[model samples]
Target: MTDVTLMDFHADWCGPCKTQDPIIEEIEEDYDEVTFEYVDVDEEPDIANEYQVRSIPTIIVKNEEGVVERFVGVTQRDTIEDALSQAGN
Candidate 1:
């Protein structure tokens, strides 16, 4: 099985992204095995567009094999925790 990574795409000025950022931080504490990557849309538009992020706060859960799940907008803690569990984090 491949390692799982969570990609969080957000902008500095986004309100909803502000809300989601903390959740990711909290998740980081609990799921240390899961890798988290933060990308600023403004700084890296190409990466964001490649992921098809039409909105801010797009959370992409990917394993080494491929993408597993995607959460757009403000993702709840439980949902993300569950995905991490499934990803073998």
Candidate 2:
């Protein structure tokens, strides 16, 4: 099985990021096999830079192959789930 990971790059004061939190949380419960990572842009600027995240909320779905999908701003749960599915989650 391919190892999949969902990375959420956000900051504490970002309103859109706040909106995206619950969606990610819900996905966490649904996709127990996929690894989830919440990266605070303030605390982890290097990681954000590595991902080239210029927006408040950037969601990256990747697997053993590479990045399968990427979303910016407030993304819907279904869209994320679709990306995860594409990544072999």
Candidate 3:
């Protein structure tokens, strides 16, 4: 099975992203199998552009092979878990 990696695409200026930060932290503590990475759009413009992340809070879940299975805004716990399960498979 491939390992799961969750990339959070966010800008420091985004209010909604700030709110989601705590929730992500909680997920990190709760799920040991999921790896979480935060990417600042201002610092990592290339990554943001590559993912076409126009929104403030975008979540991208990838397998070890680097294939994205989930891409959307403001990820919830269940959504992230589902992605992790798929990646685990």
**Which one wins on lDDT?**
2
Model 3 poorest ten-residue lDDT run: 67-76
Which ranges of candidate 3 are over 4 A from the true structure?
A: none
With a 3 Å backbone cut-off (N, CA, C), the pairs that clash in candidate 2 are none
User: What C-alpha lDDT do the candidate models reach, one value each?
Assistant: 0.89, 0.93, 0.81
Model 1: CA > 4 A from native: none
Task: Report the number of clashing residue pairs per model.
Answer: 0, 0, 0
Whole-model alpha-carbon lDDT for candidate 1: 0.89
lDDT of 3: 0.81
Candidates sorted on lDDT, descending: 2, 1, 3
> Mind giving the per-residue lDDT tens digits that candidate 1 earns over 1-89?
45889999999999999999889999999877789999999999999989999999899998876788899999999998788777764
Candidate 2 lDDT trough over 10 residues, lowest sum: 80-89
The TM-score values for the models, in the order shown, are 0.92, 0.96, 0.84
- Checking candidate 3 for backbone clashes, the offending pairs are none
